[model samples]
Target: METNEDKQAFEPKVVAFLCNWCSYAGADSAGISRLKSPANILPIRVMCSGRVSPEMILRAFRSGADGVMVLGCHIGDCHYIDANHRTVKRVTLLQNLLGYTGINPDRLVLDWVSSSEGPKFAKVTRKFVEKVRELGPMAEEMGKSLPASKINVLVEEVTG
Candidate 1:
């Protein structure tokens, strides 16, 4: 049986995808600078925001992340030259899809952050954490809007 404290102890889980060339470095800088950011974020460093696939984002949510963030180099300043452009397009489409499926699209966020922008990274992460906190547990929506069987069916329909 679950107790009130158990339910109250449910801290939202956040997954952050950070571009290695910028946002990842900025995260390291935040640690070095001892800047205080929310402790809920689980950072995953990727080579570029362009490397993030829709599958990864969906997996994060399916795996119980209350919110997700994708941080990359500023527009026109990607280390791979326009890599963030692909990221922008993909996330936008994903957001729309999430909305269509009755998911709160605000749970996902995309932002530009330079290596020098450690404070900005901290700020963005803090804000994201707060937003997710307000949304409560995403498990509350499972089997209601998006479920494994439903996602598999959607995938099959799209592919086949």
Candidate 2:
């Protein structure tokens, strides 16, 4: 039988948005190179990191992601020419906004990675997974503020 302490070590569900031209390739490279990465992250590829809007991120949270990550080309390496700038700004703001709503800002991470940095991808994902696991589940944290009924209603509004 599993002890309560064992149950307390929750595995978080993470949603990651990766730039198609860079971060996504980096993640693929990590896999091809036989690097170990946490399976908790669910990746969604976009043409550029800038394409990941706050709404999409909020939806991920509303859909029950315990953490979110946005990985893009290193500063100037964006295939779309400086598009990652928007991602940088928006993600920063979203992190603060989520914090204001009682969610820990650390739940969101933004980083840069190149396609050739396979080992770096594995390292980053592992670190992020560990960080989120320590923070525990979003649903439990959210439950302290609002009732489940309210959360379901908000989710419906967002989804619609």
Candidate 3:
């Protein structure tokens, strides 16, 4: 049984991958507009969502992010003129891979938010944070599938 301490002490950490041209700017706009979004998310600004490689997402999970978000331009609105195409393809594949590996695909989210959509950005961030808080700690659930040997390697990789 979970203690009251567990419930009161829970603070989910999230990693947000934001496209520099749009979603990152949207996040900035949200801040400028004084929209309240959860402070749990740590945003990493990339040139494009297309640049978020599989290794990076997996590394985020392995490094103790309870949830991850990928935000970019709309399907037809990529600043790189189709850069988001690769993002769509890659994230779709990554979602499936996460599911197969026994991780909840819902722990990851993909959305499009233009720089003008500060409200949308704040809403999405708040929603994702709440969802992660409900889902509890991912690292604990993941331990069921991870072998001790693999964990040792992962620990060394992260800590060394």
Q: Which candidate is the best by TM-score?
A: 3
How many clashing residue pairs are found in candidate 1? 0
Error of 2 at 44 (Å): 0.7
Worst 10 residues of 1 by lDDT: 140-149
- lDDT of candidates 1 onward, in order: 0.91, 0.91, 0.92
Residue 160 of model 1: what lDDT? Answer: 100
TM-score per candidate, in order?
0.84, 0.86, 0.87
lDDT of 1 by residue, 1-160 (tens): 5567866777889999999999999998888889998999999999999999999999999899999999999998899998799999999999999989788999999999889888999999999998888777888755455447777988899999
Q: Tell me the lDDT of candidate 2.
A: 0.91
Point out where model 1 deviates above 4 Å. Answer: 1-8, 143-160
Tens digit of lDDT per residue, candidate 2, span 1-160? Answer: 5467855778899999999999999999999999999999899999899999999998999999999999999998999899999999999999999888778999999999899999999999999999998877888777765447777988899999
lDDT of 3 by residue, 38-93 (tens): 99999999999999998999899989899999999998889899989998889989
True-structure lDDT of candidate 1: 0.91
